[model samples]
Target: MDHRTQLEERIAHLTRHVDELSEVVARQQSELDRLSRRVAMLMAREAERELDTGGSIPLADQKPPHW
Candidate 1:
């Protein structure tokens, strides 16, 4: 039809798309935050387990070639 009408239609379509994307982004952000907290908790537990198991591996002492 007319230029102004075409422009209004395009604007409406873009606004609808942007609103949908905003909702999807918000949901993804929430999921990411939950996963981050879970990961942090698991890391803390792993660290505690490592400490309870004496933290690190021990290195054996070795002598030189000479008897």
Candidate 2:
């Protein structure tokens, strides 16, 4: 094959690879976003449960041991 033809083939192959990688990255981003939201929801629920039980005051409001 001619040099020009070989270069064209290589370009096409690289383009296809780049497109596949982009799709994989997009899928991973979506999954990460979903997991983040789920974690936030779980944390909120736990905080509410703590309040209901009156287990303890929030950490920031408590006095240090030395006080």
By TM-score, who's the top model here?
1
Write one digit per residue (lDDT tens) for candidate 2, span 14-37. 999999999999999999999999
Best by lDDT: 2
Error of 2 at 55 (Å): 3.6
TM-score of each: 0.78, 0.78
Off by over 4 Å in 1: 56-67
Which residue pairs in candidate 1 have backbone atoms (N, alpha carbon, C) closer than 3 angstroms, thus clashing?
none
Candidate 2 minimal-lDDT segment of 10 residues: 54-63
* Model 1 vs. true fold: TM: 0.78
> Which 10 residues in a row give candidate 1 its minimum summed lDDT?
56-65
lDDT of 1 by residue, 1-67 (tens): 9999999999999999999999999999999999999988887777777767896622122345584
Model 2 — TM-score against the truth? 0.78
